[model samples]
Target: MGGLSSEENASSKSTSILLQIVEHSDGSVSRPFVPISAPSDDRPDATVLSKDVPLNPTHNTWLRIYRPSVLPLATKLPVVIYFHGGGFVVFSAASTFYHGLCEAMTGAISALVVSLEYRLAPEHRLPAAYEDAVETVLWIQSQARDPAAGEPWLVRHGDFSRCFLMGSSSGANMAYHAGLLATALELLPLQLLGLILHQPYFGGVERTPSEIRSEDDPILPLQANDTLWRLALPKGAERDHEFCNPVVAVPPELRHLPRCLVKGCEGDPLVDRQREFVRMLEREGASVVARVDQGGFHSVELLDPIRADSLFSEVRRFICNDL
Candidate 1:
């Protein structure tokens, strides 16, 4: 949650040094800023009991399930399939920051949360993550058909009929693409209720006003954003690739998507793109609710407890009541 140090801040104004990368001899790179895997918490007093399982063992893709510690008396809870944000390169389902965020979401929304750990970039780029997302949904659909076929927690407590796709940052991008696939293919019996995109990561060749102004942003500097996208998209693809910029080619499924919740922040460099996305969805006659906060940067919910709680409250309303 800490911002740039005084010295780093001074240096950042002159030259952005965020996300210092370390290249490995194995043709992979690393960002040494955030450590990985904080371990799943299943403490008795915890609001939710979490466990990880392989969604597709063959691909090293896995997911973490967050079930409410205290189940309701009669009703099965809504199912929220989530993707973590790491610019499509870093982080995992078990990462400390995302685990806490999902746990909070499970409690606040009173739903079953499944956080996906898709393969990262500089290794398994673009369509790989998008494919994993669709696979995740298919796996859930299989589990719903026969409770004994998959994870017992979901089989017992989840309401596949009231499902949602939610994510933050780059993860939100994955959710959007996957949502389109799900709607187009009509992955039935596993009803998709809505989409929740929190500061969706999108880019284009043109420099957005927010992006230009956030040159020295401590969390995500301009250089880091460009580098991540370069490593994520196809070998020669530009920022305007359909995967990076949703506005490039609006899919027919765009209007058919379920209700959507698009949340953006004024302080985020990608805020302009988020706003543009909302406008597009509205023009398509899609049911969309746009919330643009006057302050806060990208992934502010991750750093601020109050903001996180407020976000969860909004999500709870969106899922449990608003929709």
Candidate 2:
């Protein structure tokens, strides 16, 4: 009654919005996933040069490359093939969050970064992104097998023999898959030195300790996680499908995968699955560096500067040590 009619105010308040992706008892209806594109080549560092180039014209698949402006003479740097996390539905390679992260990582590690822009799901679906991930590796292998076919940034200074696949969330799922393929296909003269997964995304139908406990936490919630699987997983695929939960069956042999560094958070609903994955890796005799942040929530590094610094510093240590 302060300035508006009581009936009008009541109607406005009642119609206020809630869930971004709504799921009814009968069927689910999700909002369209529109990505925010960051300015091209408008990165922070003056010395770091960045640009976007298409990998496949048919699918419009592309990647953003980042490198130092002034390289130390005769010094070959490690190559990092990075994939961004969005639950496989939202965000993109050109998003400002990944842009800043890649720039900082390139500067800190003194390495070449190639951020893959894989297709989002609920539109493209599971194996689509996985296929793109594999293709990116093949692209690198092609470049290494013949320098003329390589991207300028890589051909000039990247050390393909020491390449690493780094991803977070759903992208982590892709990184693990791509690593498995690298082992089987054998990209000669280009060795995959390591796999760095920041909060590796894996899930199952059965409730785990963290999943049962941490429902509806800020960054990743239980209901949201379910909806993501619904959208990300291929049509008719179950929660325990091999793509979502590798601990099940696909890729019967985990051998040939390089050492891995998996970062998880106790406060995250996904951490329990991450822990299980580490154990599976151990059983397979694969070397793993499990770094769990006490009381840390999911994707804290995406916003908090201090947390981002700590995450990147940990990543730097893993990469440098592997080299």
Pairs with steric clashes in candidate 1:
none
State, as a TM-score between 0 and 1, how close model 1 is to the true structure: 0.92
Model 2 lDDT tens row, 1-323: 02223333223321211125554565545654544555346655577778888888898899888887778798788889999887887778887777888877788778888999988777788889988998998888888878876677788798887899999888888899888877778688888889999888888867787775544355665656666788889899988898898888746558778889999878777888999999999888888999888877777667777878887788788988842
Clash pairs of candidate 2?
Answer: none
Give the per-residue lDDT of model 1 (tens digit) for 1-323: 22233354334452433366655888699665655554345576776888888888889998889988999979999999999998898877877889888888888889999999998898998989999999999989988877777678888889989999999999999999999988767577789989999999998878788876665887777767877898899999998899998887899989889899999889999999999999999989999999988889888998999989988988989997564
Count backbone clashes in candidate 2.
0
Each candidate structure's TM-score, on Cα atoms with residue i matched to residue i, is: 0.92, 0.87
Candidate 2 vs. true structure, TM-score: 0.87
Give the best candidate by lDDT: 1
After superposing candidate 1 on the true structure, give the runs of residues whose Cα lies further than 4 Å from its correct spot. 1-18, 24-27, 36-42, 321-323
lDDT of 1: 0.85
